[model samples]
Target: MHVLFLAPEVWPFKRVGGLAEVAYDLPRALAALGHKVGVVTPKPRLSQEMEQGLERLDTVLEVPVSWKRHLAEVYRHQEPSGVEVYLIGHEHLFDREGLYGNAYGDYEDNAERFIFYSRACLELARTMDWRVDVFHANDWTTGLVPVYLRTLYAGDPCLKDAASLMTVHNLGNQGQFWHYDMPLTGLGWEYFVPEALEFYGQINFLKGGLVFADMISTVSHTYAQEILTPELGRGMEGVLMARRDRLAAVVNGIDYQVWNPADDYRLAANYDRHDPSPKARCRQELMGHYGLEDGGGRPLVAVVGRLEDRKGLDLITAGMERFFEVGLNLVVMGYGEDHYHVALGELAARHPGRLGLTIGFDIDLAHRIMAGVDMLLVPSRYEPCGIHQMQALRYGVVPVVRDTGGLADTVVDQRPGVEGTGFKFEPFTMEAMLQTLDRAKQAYDRPQEWRGLMQRAMAQDFSWQAVAPRYEEIYRKALELAGQRQRA
Candidate 1:
């Protein structure tokens, strides 16, 4: 099958979050399965070193947005994994310092920018004579791809028959813009009704995708169910529930090649599940780098990823004193929310050698932390699908994650006689998190049990190779639905 993926961010080119990583890895995984996979993303302002690799195409795509015609230049690059990447370049709209927005917040013209990009994706496919079987749209950024496919490009011979599958990475970001911006979509006001594009008094891009696309998917099975409820739905529950039959969940996968501890050059010393003694060297290096001292063999636990309230950073802050009293050393990485920065910094100062904090993301440091940390903390309030837990498991590092979404699906809670990989807490409370931490520490204190747990985690496989076939199955089902729609 020929699948063309449309996403706002693709790693190595532009990456703001997990969506970027998925865009890069999933297509490569699909290509490896002997299917033709192509990715279309907006070309942002990149470093000169990165830009040299792109081959600018002569074709100028005439994209219609609202009443005006916008011309877009295309750049092509063939990835090492044989996946073809096409970057739609629009200097005024996309050539910015940030992919979505700068430090101020989201770009004011975000709806307009993505509207142009979505239309350009179809134009690129048609111009290149690439017959796309499935136009897999990711998140609200490319949500209109499906809407445009069934509307504006419905009669176009090249793209008319292509099926669309819209994957919602997070329901919280629905791309709700002012109702007046409906004109920017170049669709009639009829689409602005409650049953279609309109949400409350705004134009909702994601809602349109849910209504128009043949099939919809999210990151994990549990999350697929979660979004149908009011709590996690973020006000899209009714639309999602109406199309519940069309919705499915496939847990996100990690690239084992990039995450394998035995082969990771970023680690202080390489080790696998079989011989994890080298992890001690990595642990020492990580501590030395952070100015943290080994606390008489206390288990070292680390929190990685964005430090926001949604990630249960509040729980971490609330339980910090108790966690330290219980003989646990803590290290934090990744940056988010200024309040967390100040709070965690103050805590680190108070605890001196016991607490270590790094305010931003560094890929090299991430690898070292994963390899060295005895336990990885992922107590999210609600996680769609977490990649960190999977990455930690691959490195023989046990995860202590909240029992929700993909974390619940991936991490098996350790119990007596259960061949569990890690620890889990159900309630989203600091007390629950602390209790789970105590259980993990108790297990860590028992060297034999801790080694068993680590080995069990490392043996688990959440690789893209194992996950790609499921996507293929969904694409086939989506094609079936498309055929039914065409017949009607």
Candidate 2:
């Protein structure tokens, strides 16, 4: 099979979140299975380091955006895993200080920027010598791909047999804009009705993709079902319900090459479940680095993600004082929301030796935290598929997470047998979280039991090799759907 992946960001080149990581790993995994995979993403302001060696194609694509046309330079590079990467360069639109926007906010012309990129992707496919079997798009940024394929380019021979799959990483961020911006899409007004792009009197890019794509998938099976309801759907329940048969829920996978503790370059001491003496050394080093007492006689719990309301950081803030009373030390690393920054700063100051805080991302530190911490906390309001917990499990760090979405699917609450890997809580409240922490502490007190749980976690596999077949099955299903639609 020949597959083309369209995403706004790809790992090691331009990454802001998990989508980039998936965009990088999934295609490589497929390519390893003998599928010819290609990735297309915007070329951000590249440093000399990011563009070391790449074949630049002389072909300049003239992409139309509404009434105007923009030129883009295409460059090709091959990954070590044999996947080809195509970068679209439009300095005026993509070569920015950040991927989407800077610290202030998202770029005001985001709708237009992505619309242009989507059209370019289609044009690139239309002109390429090889035929594409699947055009897999990710998130709201590439939402217009399916729309263009089914609408304006419906009759184009090149794309008539190609299928599209749109994977929604987060339904919360539906690309919604004023109805006036519909012209920017270079698509007809007929697409702006409620059944298509329109969402509560506005133009919704994600809705357009979901409506037109041969198939739709969320990051996790639990999240796929969650989004079909009003509370979690973010106002797309009706449209999604209409395409229920076309929806899929494949859990995301992690690249073991980068995350494996036995050979990780980032960890202070590399160790796996078989040899965990290095993990204790890492814990001691981390405690000293944070200025906390190395021998506190308490479990060290860590939080590593954006400190936003959606992450349920507020729940931690609400229960911090009580958590300390239960004899546990805390370490946090992330940056988000001015209020959270200020609140976390004050809390860290008050607790001094008991709490440690790092305001920004440190990749090395994140790996060390996963290797060192006794427990990892992720009390998200709703998580599509969290990579942190998966990485934590890989490092033998027990995760105490809210039982929702992927967390619910992956983490098995501590049970009597050897099957248990982590702890979970319900209702998503401070009280429930604190009680869950108490349970973790109880298990922690029993060193024999905790070690068994850690062993179980490290033994569990969340690698892409385990998940690539599921995606392959979905791709075949999508092709069948597209063939039917084409015949109709």
Candidate 3:
């Protein structure tokens, strides 16, 4: 099968979050399975310098916007694994310093920008010599592709039978704009109704895809179920419920080649499940790197990612006193809201050598933490699918996560009778989080049980090798659905 992955960003080229990583890993996995896979992403400003091995292609894409023709230069990057990435270049819209927006806020022109990219994706498919079997779009950025295929380019033979699948990484971030922007879609006003792109009084790009795509999927089965309810759906539960049969939930997988502890160059010492010697060295190195004290026998717990409300970071802040009282050393990495920055910094200062805080993202440090830390903290209020917990498990670092979304699906609570991967807690509150941590700490004291838990976690397979076949099945379902729709 020939597949085209349409996303706003691609990993190692333009990345803002886990979506880019998913955009990078999944296609490569599919290609490795003997499928013809290509990724289409907006050309980032740093592409020329960052994309070392890619060569420019002769293909030029001219996409029709509402009234004008938008021209984009096409460049192709062929991975050694046979996956080809086609970058759409438009200086004004894409070649900015940021993938989506700057520090101030999201770019004001995001609606127009992605609209053009979505339209250009379809046009690029029409112009290319190879016909695509599936046009797989990610998040709200590429939402319009399914809409364009069903409406704007409905009669075009090249894509008339091609299936579209919209994978919602986060329903919280639906691309919504004022109703005035609806005219820019080039879709008829009939599509502006409540059942289509319209959400409340606004034009929602994500709704367009949800209504038009042959199928829809979320990163995890739990998330797919969560989005059908009032609390987690972000106002689209009814729409999702209407098309329940077409929705799927497949857990996102990690790129083992990059994340494997046995081969990771970023770590101080390379160790696998067999040899546990280097893991101790890694822990020592992590302590030295953070300027924290060693030989104290305190369990090292690391929190990596955005420190914000949604991440349930406040629960950590609320339990900081208990964290120290229990003789736990905490290392925090990643930047977010200003208040969290100030709060965490103050806590670090108060705790001195016991707490280590890094305000920004460091890929190397992240890998080191996963390798060295005793536990990883992911207390998200609602996580669609977290990549860090998966990476943590890969390195044999037990994840202590709130039982929600992918965390609920992946992490099994370790008990006296049942050997599990990590620790999990329900009820998104400080009390529950602290109690779970206490349980984990109690388990930490039992070396025999702890080792067994680590072994189980490391033995677990979260790689795309196990996940891609499920995606292939969904792709086939999408094709059948598309064919049925066309026939009707």
TM-score to true structure, per model: 0.98, 0.97, 0.97
Per-residue alpha-carbon lDDT of candidate 3 for residues 376-477, written as tens digits (9 for 90 to 100):
999999999999999999998999999999999999998777789999998998888888888898888888888888888988899998999999999999
Model 1, 1-488: lDDT tens digits are 99999998998898777888899899999999999999999999999998999999999999988998999999999999999999999999999988878879899999999999999999999999888999999999888899999998999999988999999998878888999899999999999999889888999898889889999999999999999999999988988898899898999999999999999999889999999989999999999988887868989998999899889999999899999988899989988888899999999989999999999888889999998899999999999998999999999989999998999999999998897999999999888888889999999989999999999999999999999999999999999999999999
* Top candidate, metric lDDT: 1
| C-alpha lDDT values of all predictions | 0.92, 0.89, 0.89
- Give the range where candidate 1 is weakest over 10 consecutive residues by summed lDDT: 12-21
- Model 2 pairs whose backbones collide: none
Q: For residues 213-259, what per-residue lDDT tens digits would candidate 2 score against the true structure?
A: 99999988899899999999999888899999999998998989889
**Candidate 3 segments whose C-alpha is farther than 4 A from its true place:** none
- Judge candidate 1 against the unseen true structure and give its global Cα lDDT, from 0 to 1: 0.92
Off by over 4 Å in 1: none
